[model samples]
Target: MISYSKIRTIAAEKKLMDIVIEKDYVLDWILWGISENDYLKYNLVFKGGTALHKMYFSDWRFSEDLDFTCIKPINVDKLREALILICKDVNNKSGMKIELKSIEASGDTKEDWSYEIKVEYLGPRQQSGGNLPTIILHITYYEPILYEPVKRTILKSYEDIPGDFFILTYPLEEIFAEKLRTVLYQRCYPKDVYDLWRLTKEVGD
Candidate 1:
């Protein structure tokens, strides 16, 4: 049982309100489309470096680009089209230009899973410190190759504001695993190492 006030304090201490808000809006748009289409059979998850697992247990400072996973297999083209249409509609009403980046689809033979749909936002780019591009959106599908796709809902560590339900993301454990792999494969950043260390300590218990 994670306390909301603890999460709120960490967010405030790290000045992560803006990033959290942006992530919320982007996810809300995706969820709205899925819900409207009666695609609730699919489960959505928010994962990656941006979702700080360490913060689940104790306060820590970290940052991440948006990454998500959809457990239902989907028509990649249709999903992209739907996302574009939703972005356009939202922009029209809110005057926020949310552009979709190119979509990427791939499969995981080892895990017996396939994924489709990669949504990216091209508008209102946010820069962190001096270099990192603040990615606004990402969506991916995960399905087991041998079995029917399973519906798994993992709540994210963030406040849910009205009209922005997408902000509620996947579990910190998933994010921690992805981040650990990222650090192992790529030239690791200090923050990534730090985040991994802190997250491991928290989840280890």
Candidate 2:
């Protein structure tokens, strides 16, 4: 966990909301927790908008939730256990209070699972009377890996206390493909358009 003052200073420097800065720090700690969890380390491959920011490009938009594709189908009970333990480990190491509040299954089955893990934080922002913010983990099980998952280091912005940790994530090519899918088949989100354009600029048309 980053110091309250340090977090505030960052928010000021970036001209962003204080809570956003706090959430970013909490995100790092939570990912650090996942890094230490052996099951989550290999099973969950990080992806989506947050992955774009954390693994691929800086100057990308800040992301609110964590999206991961579980390589194998896992039951709710086992998933809950791993996540609860992760929150505990993070609290112990970072002195930041957090919990796996609930795991909600929107759709999907035991064979192909999708869960939303809400991690509520009693972080520095709580001092400012903001509601306890949650970091949502969108975990989808029984997903095929389109490309070879690569190990990537977290791109941290807050003050550094802990060292390096790596997680498996989609390569830039896979990310572009997925983002393009969203833009074409889904709602054509503004972020998708922006991301696709950025990717084109980075790797060429």
Cα lDDT tens digits for candidate 1, 1-205: 1233544465576677644545444454444444344343245454555544311332445433445566655566766666677657655544445566656555654233334344544223333255332234455554222223223322333333124233334455655666677799875998788878877776785
How does candidate 2 score on lDDT? 0.82
Q: What lDDT does each candidate get?
A: 0.49, 0.82
RMSD of 1: 7.9
Best by lDDT: 2
lDDT of 2 by residue, 1-205 (tens): 6677887898898898888988878888888889998878998899888888887776788888999988877668888898899999988888889988899886655666688889998886556465677899999875567899999988766555366789899888778887888788877878779888888787565
Superposition TM-score, candidate 1 onto the true structure: 0.52
Q: Pick the candidate with the highest TM-score.
A: 2
Where is the poorest 10-residue window by lDDT in model 2?
A: 124-133
